[model samples]
Target: MKVKELMTKKVLVLKPNNTFEEAAKLFIENGIDGAPVVDKDGKLISIITKTDLMKAILNKWKMNERIETLGPKKVTTINGEMNLEDVLKYKVSRLPIIDKNNKIIGIITQTDLINNLVEKITKKYRDLKNTKLSLMELDSVIECSYDGIYITDGEGNTIKVNNAYERITGLKKEAVLGRNMRELELEGFISQSATLLVLKNGETTTIQQEFNTGVKVLVSSNPIFDKSGKIIMVVTNVRDVTQLYELKEQLQRNKEITRKYVSEIEEMRTQLLNTSEIVAEDHRTIEIIQLANRIAKVDTTILMLGETGAGKDQIAKHIHKVSKRSKKQFIKVNCGAIPTSLIESEFFGYEKGAFTGANKEGKIGLFELASGGTIFLDEVGELPMDMQVKLLRVLQEMEVVRIGGTKSIKIDVRVLAATNRDLEEMIKKKQFREDLYYRLNVVPLYIPPLRERKQDIFPLINFFLTQLNKKYNFNKVFASDALNCLYEYNWPGNVRELKNIVERVVIMSEDDKIKRLDLPKNIIGSNGMVVTLNTFEEGINLKETLDSIEGKLIKKAYDKYGNVRAAAKSLGIDPSTFVRKRQKYINNIDAQYKT
Candidate 1:
């Protein structure tokens, strides 16, 4: 608080020429200990206190001596805006308050300072009381939280434990409270104490703490510090993730089962989806495949870019099958799917007895296995930094070195990388090496998303339909209305989502044809209605009809592609034209709405 709020007003002042006797009389009359001595212009000169007056009286000082001479020739005066902290730094009991004119405005005495301190202490007490009341109100929420909570002091002594903490750890609050984390750990109440770690290091820590009762909890401990940069408290949030881990394990098991089923189905479909005969009816798709074919003629690194489910894998496979090394082995590796710990051994084989549980006769790695062929690295952005360095070295040296072997074996293999992620962004973030990215991105090709290539959607749907019919011996067709919905709906998951939907419709439809009712709501509600030409009674206005057709095509493209640029690309029109036409239709809709 500012000193002005506590400084005493109506301050008694003495002229610089005032005698010691006059000062003493004024001090007694005002019942004050001190007063400011100022000159005729009302500017502060010095200060005289009761001690100075009494000392002068005993010594019988001369009357000619000015009151300013009694105490100090120069005195410290503070501005009204100065804070209490600044005031305390001065070692005097009485101080004069001054304004911009250097005139004495008021005085701060010892009694005033004491009173202000008492007021501050009372306010602090009230604030602390309010804080306690607020904490009491939120006690129920803390107890009801799904995650367990525990708080400890800087000394690692437990202060509070929530109900969830007791419930998850099977320990009573009484047993845990008043006992420090180290004590609890020694007693085997908790296998580990993250709170202790936070207290020691003063940093937030997350750890899995196991209890002697066989329950595992994920705990995150955060240290709260005071203004002095010292830890005052540690708050730990604990969650019983045993069930979560179990659920993840079950999901992995289900994923394995699904993988086996999909593998079998893909093996069967491989006979039909010949690498040389991939469906590429759209001009853009045909152009991309031709580029891939040219890149495949040689054995240089190739990078494929596209959205997930946009058939990046299909492009990689086509490149591998058409390359000069097509007669040799073709190995596909999903960099993201492998664990970081096992990725090195997976890429380069380990020698026999290299480490514990090593293969007796050693095993061949992907680089060794695909010595004379191509190895496709799918989702290559997930490679760790160390592995990226090793992979780059292998690429540059054209050889392989086993984990335990000292000698490098020379090899001849082509590398192809593909990722849905933006490797350029990853390179900027330092997550992916720029050198490795350049090596892999030697011949980069990007395949447009399914929505941008709507012309190819019907072809893909028909191909899946033919294959599904042949495999299941069913001749199912889609109705006109259903086909319209499928065309209007944007394929976010691209060809994979389209193929899955087609297969599901084929299997679920009881009738020979799939109707609008059989399609998913997303597809049916993608757009309000199919835009069709309406016949007029007299005749069609050529200009108006053409405008209407142009506007409808622009709107349809925008609806399917979700942007003017992609829509323009799909319709082979300029983005500006697409934007203008789309805006005209939007204005027409808005005007109709207002009316």
Candidate 2:
């Protein structure tokens, strides 16, 4: 319980300027031994008590002297949010309750706590007296309970055994009622007694017991304490566990079946991704795919941030395919495609006859349609500021009211949004809502551009090539030089541009083999840059010269890209390889300086 619950709300507060006589009069009239002292602005200054006034009298202070003059200025106060038990730790008779602003709001006194505790104990005793009308009724109540009840005296002598106990233990009440628990255990009638354990420990105890009939039961014994803190009786509750053990075995079988199903489902999701043309050869891309798969199991808003054509939509689809809502609809909405005037109605739907050219029947909104499923909002950054507010509310409440409908339709849709714009900058520009941005960016997944994850480009080229081949029923292949040029050219449009280019070359080129000359002029021009070779010196070691040249190119790429992975992609090497080579050059330079 909180301190505020027990604290006296209407507390008599004295002012610091109040004289000792006035303070004494207020205390006597209110029947309070102490009162909080505050300034004119209601801020706590100190506490004045009857003791302080007595001290004032002993010091021969005049009655007109201020009460604050006699008491100590430092006072201990408890926050209203503190627990009631916190009051017990302080030795002070009265504690002032203050809010966060340090202004007195209430007061808790020792008498108030004692009175409250006494009232609770009195109520408990009254309830116990009312329940104990006759021994027959008590026996009936215990017999009606599904669990077995066994009562024993503090000395561990069984006093009573209900019908349920006989049924559970297969022992007659007459056989155990007058028997001692230790004697029963010694005679091998029962394995152990919870009553004996509780009496020995002076506390509640629970254990699994077995009877000579080979029946297992869970037993819990609670000790009843008297006024002097002496244990008077122990009540043991018994539950048959033979069926529970069987049920536990069945549950284990069910868990095994569940594991098999989960493994099969994961395999199916992998196959789904393979068919969906997702190439995850790049370490970065593979990491993103793994993260997406992990987060798909949970229902959380995900924001896919990437450049245009970076396969954000594909990742969103992959997440849906692996999610628990895989069997349900995966609705995709292009926020940028919808017209501004019709955006709200298109997203939220509208009631019949609510607007001009409205559908005759009331339409279900995208959120409602995707209920128990997933919704993909592509180009989410393009949504208007006003629409962002509505979207944020729908996400927050998980419900939406149609454009012209008064009732809110509850939804259980998982939101997956993708954007190619800088939402943080947009928020600063007031083009987007900051709250909406944070709601959508709960789990942000950034897909690296094609240039940054160049290793995946070749696999994606093959994937799209094979797909287009099967679709068009044509046999086409790219020559080694053409492939090299394609790999060398930077794809600003990311995966989408790569797929389009592959399709274009496969369809446009007449030859069976796509040669370097058949490639796009831009691709060739971008890859045609030449390197300048320095004049060869007589003492130049061929390997050392080549190493120096490689080091310079690596350093240049690293400096320009400012990212290890991207720089490695530019150098056509792995990130680990880049790091190793960079360290190697540094070590060589240090060794040269040492020499």
* Top lDDT model: 2
TM-score of 1: 0.43
Q: Tens digits of per-residue lDDT for model 2 on 1-595?
A: 4434544534344443445456546654664444444433324444444432212223232333342342333323344343344444432234344444545454433334333433543343344425544444565787798989987766776656778889888997656755789999999999998888888888889999999989999999998776667776788999999899989999999999999998996685466455465877777887888788899999989999998778898999999988999999999997755666777887888899888888989788888899999999997976877899999899999988997789998899999999877888777878789999899999999988889998998899888889878988989998999999999988866777777678778877998899998876657884432334755446656665577677678768865764455677888887667767764552333233223
Query: Which residue pairs does candidate 2 place in steric collision?
Result: none
Record all residue pairs in model 1 with backbone atoms less than 3 Å apart, i.e. clashing: none
Estimate the overall C-alpha local distance difference test score of candidate 2: 0.72
Taking all chains together, each candidate's TM-score versus the true structure is 0.43, 0.44
| RMSD, one per candidate, in order | 32.1, 30.7
Per-residue alpha-carbon lDDT of candidate 1 for residues 474-510, written as tens digits (9 for 90 to 100): 9998888888889888887687778777877787788
